[model samples]
Target: MNFAYELPWYRKFINESDLVFCDGFGVLWGAKLCGYCIKSDNRMTCPDYIENLALACEQENISLFLLAGKPGTVDKAIAKLKAIAPNLKVKGHHGYFEKIGDENEAIINEINKFRPDILYVGFGMPLQERWILDNLTRINAKVFLPLGACLDYYTDAVYRGPRWMTDRGFEWLTRLVIEPQRLWQRYLIGNPLFFYRVFRALIASSWKNYSKMSKFWRT
Candidate 1:
């Protein structure tokens, strides 16, 4: 019952599986294009991500922890989990971001001692993913889900746009409306850059797949 988490490089350990990279905007589309099963429920608040995750932990009877995100967010996140799924059993939890520096031995040490089955790090992409890539072996976990801003959104610490707006793929826009000053850079710069990279990857993958199929038929 070994589940391989996403780390693109960790593919070596996961001979056969999707190992999604925990991004509704990035890996979800990546998985769609690559034929891997990408799983996420973006229901505005989208507690399902953690809800399903809690179910996974309960089924496995393995320890789990929220390893990153703003202070107090994890506690707040847990409350929603309890509210949404009161019966769900969690092994344990912790949170501390911004304060943790590079090498973050304390964080690594704590995780190692508990040896959880899953580590849901919502420190945002690349950074969260990179954290897992750099630390997972040292820490104990079969699955690592690096979620970006998921904790804030899920915990209700931050607000999500209305359902209609979210459905239209402009939840980020609604967010900007709510927290204009704080979110300006994320929506203005990060959002566009994220889509650009996503689409670019899609194009590259499509061309590669077409080339492969064309060569196969030709031969």
Candidate 2:
């Protein structure tokens, strides 16, 4: 929601996406306030569902290429994934390379050579989304999945907090506590700001509807 609120282009990208799921409670609640029937069960965070995704891909004989995380982080995540699904075919590259010119071309060539069924890019929100928009036509992968910081959690490079907190939509609180220096603004200010925007939009929508009803009654 913050991404959409901050970057108008981001909303267009999401709307153009073939599939979009609720990855956080903010989006779920926002949808509810907008009169959508989204529920907690509909939320699927990558850290929570990644193992299952690997297992399912293994069973379905789908190949995965992970392009995210710092140096060595993606390799560690692939190692953990292989442990969970021994037969899973997966490869990975760190997201530290340049996104344009020679370096970007090389990475694209590498991915095309691998010909993965799914490509996971986790350079973070707007950047990852922009990369996909720019290179989707040239990429050989069948699916483009943007996962922010998921590999860090998979490799334990970043702590994801207890299951209790994460399961109950308090993962933001946990993250705020864990990386206060890095993420203070995102969770501290961004969360409340997101909700405020949601409510504002909801109220505006309600008033519009009420005005329409009033006109109908007068007619």
Candidates in order have lDDT scores of 0.61, 0.91
Which pairs clash in model 2?
A: none
Evaluate model 1: give its TM-score.
0.63
Model 1: CA > 4 A from native: 1-18, 21-46, 83-103, 179-219
Write down the TM-score of every candidate. Answer: 0.63, 0.94
RMSD of each: 6.5, 1.4
73, model 2: CA deviation in Å? 1.0
Best by TM-score: 2
Q: How many clashing residue pairs, candidate 1?
A: 1
Query: How much is 19 displaced in model 1, in angstroms?
Result: 1.9
lDDT of 2: 0.91
lDDT of 1 by residue, 1-219 (tens): 011233455454334434533434444554555576655553223353567766655666666677655667777776766665565544334444442575377777767787767677766544665566666567777767655677777767777767676655677787788888977986797656765665777789899999999999999
